[model samples]
Target chain A: MHELSLMEAVRDQALAAAHADGAIRITVISLRVGELAGVELEALRFAFPVAMAGTIAAGAELRIESEAAECHCTACDAPFPAPDGCCDCPRCGAISRQLLRGRDLRLLSLEVV
Target chain B: MCRDCACGEPAPDPAAVPASAPRELTLHTALLQRNDAGAAALRQRFAAAGVRAVNLLSSPGSGKTALLEALAQRLDPTRLAVIVGDLATDNDARRLQAAGVPAVQITTGQACHLEASMVAEGVHRLNHQGISLEQLELLVIENVGNLVCPGAYDLGESLRLVLLSTTEGEDKPLKYAPIFHGADLVLISKIDLAEAVGFDRAAAHAAIARVAPHAQVLEVSARSGAGLDALIEALGLALPAVR
Candidate 1:
């Protein structure tokens, strides 16, 4: 639902990166999306072109890499997959101590010029 | 190719790009970085002023306004101020203002969530309206009446409060586990109507524990002035001195 603003940030970051490198055209924007990042990839894809239109990133290919949410259980010293940041370990049923992954909405790389 | 040429020259095809030769720059940046920075700045300001900023989250009609009003009457109005966010109207702010406290309304035109930047603006407006940050002991921000978008935003609050009305259902915590889990305090509002609505107290408490075991749960009725004292004490607001 709020992916439009997030895509705008991506567009701005991609443009800044391209401008810093003296690249006039951005060929591709690669993003790392997590399952628990509260971002919908399809919605982001839909908003990308609209946000990047008329900019240096116009017509750029948006490549997305999806990552699953993972959690760490400090109780039993185990790493496991969990849905959200707060999750009980499947192995021990103890509350996870740390969220290992799946909350990242990283603009990983940009292909430009 | 002519730069800025109005001629109808087709742009290069993005699909047929040779990936082997493309120059890739590694730019690992999080999308929420900007918002995070803003939140950090707000937190710094709150720390400097020695003020506790509380972010209140709940669904619509959860009596967030009523609770704030009750607190306003209990505490020193000069020490407490509120920032209310709504989609269309400033009625919540008006209600809080009627309680004789400084209240600012942030009407999110299209945005579903209130971000750190909005809090900054709201505080600025409140200050402009004669509520200085240095004098305020507490600043309460009542977020928009939604559980989803506000969960993702960090408004640089000293504490995060999530409210659940009994009429909403006992399984609300289970339904919205992420938001519930993120809360520092989970308040059950409108307990006065619990018996009339057949609100299952045990089930709700169990659900809240299952989802947010770390959060302190308090049952309150804003209308009856029930449990507000316990809340004030939990917040360490020093009611007797302030009142």
Candidate 2:
């Protein structure tokens, strides 16, 4: 998957943040990945070590929080739990809806020391 | 919690992590923020130059090239150019070039989709080929043909056009809702094959309405040239023939 490139970027950000915080190294990098973010968690776990090699994030623990997909129907503004490609509104049966979450891929924090 | 040694210890649980519990720095930064930054820069570049850069997204065999070719024959030759992205060959770019449009190919190799950085490089490569981005009125980016992967990556276009051919089926918008959700325009291509394929136009429109209520739907056929003029008009392109 494209997790390697994304992890490489996470490593870079971790290093910069650690440097700015005056830490000798990064201990952990926490990330929030949504279900609809198109990232494979297993691939991201496999890519972490290689992506962080030779950097401040070398061997740094990667914590990934998987968020569930949720959406709201565009027609009647009905909220619904959208997972596994289920996007229709239960209330209005309207297909079009504004996606409220489940597309996130964020680095929540960096444990540095 | 060491930076180097892995001494038979289990990785910490990702779910039980508290916002400010164990981490030293509460960064709260989006992991793909760099991609967002890149996209923002590209958007600014296009805006500054007043370029109408459209990112065309579709599944393979959705007639993106055919539509672009139709546009090539219709739009101003001097002002229109293309940047084609594909996983392997530059066949689409070659086809566009053959249609008399300045086309640059960005072969993504193993990548599934084209990123903003790749678009930047494509523009640079086009500049090297004496096809300046500034001179062109339209810069069409033919994204690697996949509805799923390209949905997340923004190539920073003025418009995002998602194409669904009639043969593909009516459930496409429902199945790949995210792609349709982000599209500025939803083009129903290959409408000429509707009769042969039993393509239900009403159902397709209904599906699109469910997923992308804001997207303007246009039915076009590159083969019979039906709705090609309307397609050009949708892009707000002042065709040479009309001029």
Best by DockQ: 1
lDDT of 1 at A49: 92
- Candidate 2 structure quality by residue, lDDT tens digits, B23-125: 4898888876777888899999988887899999999989999998987777777788899999888899899988999999999998889999999999998
Position A89, candidate 2: lDDT: 76
Task: List ranges where model 2 is wrong by over 4 Å.
Answer: A24-27, A53-61, A73-78, A84-87, A95-97, B1-22, B239-243
Off by over 4 Å in 1: A84-86, B1-21, B241-243
lDDT of 1 by residue, B29-131 (tens): 9878899899999999999999999999999999999999988888888899999999989899999988998999999988878999999999999889988
Could you tell me the TM-score of candidate 2?
0.84
lDDT of 2 at B91: 90
Clashing pairs in 2: A95-B210, A96-B210, A106-B31
Fnat per predicted structure, each in turn: 0.51, 0.56
**CAPRI-style class, candidate 1:** acceptable
> Roughly what TM-score does model 1 have, to 2 decimal places?
0.87
